[model samples]
Target: MKETELRYVLALLRVQGIGDIFAKKLIQHCGGAEAVFTADAAILHRIDGIGEIAIQRLKAPAVLEKADAELEYIRKHNIKVLYYQDDDYPERLKHCIDGPVLLFTAGKISFPEQKIISIVGTRQVTPYGTEFCKKLIADLAPLNPVIVSGFAYGVDIVAHQAAMEHQLQTIGVLAHGLNQTYPPAHRKYCPKMEENGGFVTEFWSSSNPDKENFVKRNRIVAGMSEATIVIESAGKGGSLITAGMANDYNRDVFAVPGRVTDKYSQGCNNLIKTQKANVLTDAADLVYMLNWDLAAEKCKPVQKQLFVALEEEEEKVYQYLNSKGKEVIDRIALECNLPIYKVASLLLKMELKGVIRPLPGKLFEAV
Candidate 1:
């Protein structure tokens, strides 16, 4: 977009009560950002959402001055500004109703037709979560999926680091502006991350990483990707919110299962129990659900290679689930001639082993 046009767009964004959806509506009715400023009063009144107050806001000189200052900062920093209608903007994101009208990016970024998945979890990541996050990326290394995350602590940073370890491109979606990095410890990773995959945000130079921004940030993480995977979370956390957004976007959502006793696992477990998310044991589960197998099936069609050995009893449960598609726990014990307690124990072990997964209402199915 031309600098003149960008100036108008920025000013429009600064208008109070005019959010992304409304901004897009205004632009559509007014022809373009620049035209919005010059449109006749009669024309402006005809637009559905544009009224006296909005027109008054548009006429404010202060808005243009602020936009000019922000434009200068962006130019100085060499940030790539993506207008919502630009050809280079993320195509998947454009389809989202609440996607930003402008996105500022810094880094060497590319969103090819290859897989792009967001991996999110608790900021206080557990050792188990770390291992699983690392292993999942490692298993997916061959495909070189573009890893996306919040760029915060815990699973977000771990996912980025794992992707870096495998030389895969990784993008960090920040709640703050590109002018600074939050959690200064993460500053060290910013340079290397930008070299491969950089930071992207809708926030401008003046915005700080406040509490509310993180929740708003979750929508971008969820909207841009075809799917989202929750590595671990508490019963209520931002990660679950991101998963919910992904589901609302009609994107695939996956949650790693953890023991019911673990606090962080409760969120993920509840997601599965409620059927809000699919059971994501390993990369293969994601691969199968997303039909990523089409890419690897050419070289290797060993989806079952992801499975591990089950004990004689666990095997009985696994085979039963595999054959039946999904079975309730009591029925599995009755069919396998095992006690309900023993079946429950075997199911937990099997779930941990990634052979079978638990569904809502006590259903179990083979992975």
Candidate 2:
């Protein structure tokens, strides 16, 4: 795109109350960002949502100055400005109505025939969540999928590190601009991250990591990916919001089921229960859902449930475990109306029988 056109697009962005959606609409109706300013009354009248106030704001001198400053920063820092209409822009996001008109990115990024998935969850990720994230990335490494995450902490940083370890391209979609990292502690990873796939945001250098910006950022993470896998979440958080946006976008969504009693697992459990997400145990579930070539990528086959006979008491415990996804022996005993000792003995037998496996934190799940 022309330098002049980008300046106009950036100016459109600086207009108060003119977000990505309205900005894109204005640009579309006017033929280009530059054309929007010079558009006559007839041109503006034909645009559905344009009003007199919007036209006046479009002519504001301060907006152009701010855009020029941002454009200068882009040129000075060698930042790649991805226009929504351009080939370098994310294809998945282009289909989204509220996708950014211009995305400022800094990275060795390319999306040529790639599989992209966004892994998101609470910043206070548990050990179980960390293990599941690392394992998921490791298993998906064979397919060379691009890992996308918020880069905040916990599951995000873990996913990025695991992807880097596997030498797969990973992008940290930022809530702030590329001028600075939000968590400052994550600054060290920036250089290494840009080497593979780096940071991206719609905000200019003038923007900071405000609270609302994070929510807005979630849409990009959810929009660009073929699917969004929530590793873990509480009853409320940004990850669940991302899953909602992905659902709104009609993209496949998956959630790793956690024990019903676990605090961090509540959001995922609810998503699964409400049928917002498919049950995701492994990368195989994703590959199967996305219809990625099974032969081309070597993902471990999903294990089919074993048809095993059980005593009445054992069957009750087994059903409880299966229903909860994962459960501790105590929870099982209490829920199934069995004594703790009896449940422990049954679990031992179940483990020996290769029907269930024990997890860290005394959790057990049907195999």
- lDDT string for model 2 (69-110, tens) is 998999999999899999989999999999989888888988
Find the candidate with the highest TM-score and give its number.
1
- By summed lDDT, which 10 consecutive residues of candidate 2 come out lowest? 294-303
lDDT of 2: 0.86
> How displaced is residue 92 in candidate 1, in Å?
1.1
Candidate 1 to truth, TM: 0.81
Candidate 2 Cα misplacement greater than 4 A, ranges: 297-367
**Backbone clashes per model, in order?**
0, 0
* TM-score per model over all chains: 0.81, 0.80
lDDT scores of the candidates, listed in order? 0.87, 0.86
Off by over 4 Å in 1: 294-367
- Pairs that collide in candidate 2 are none
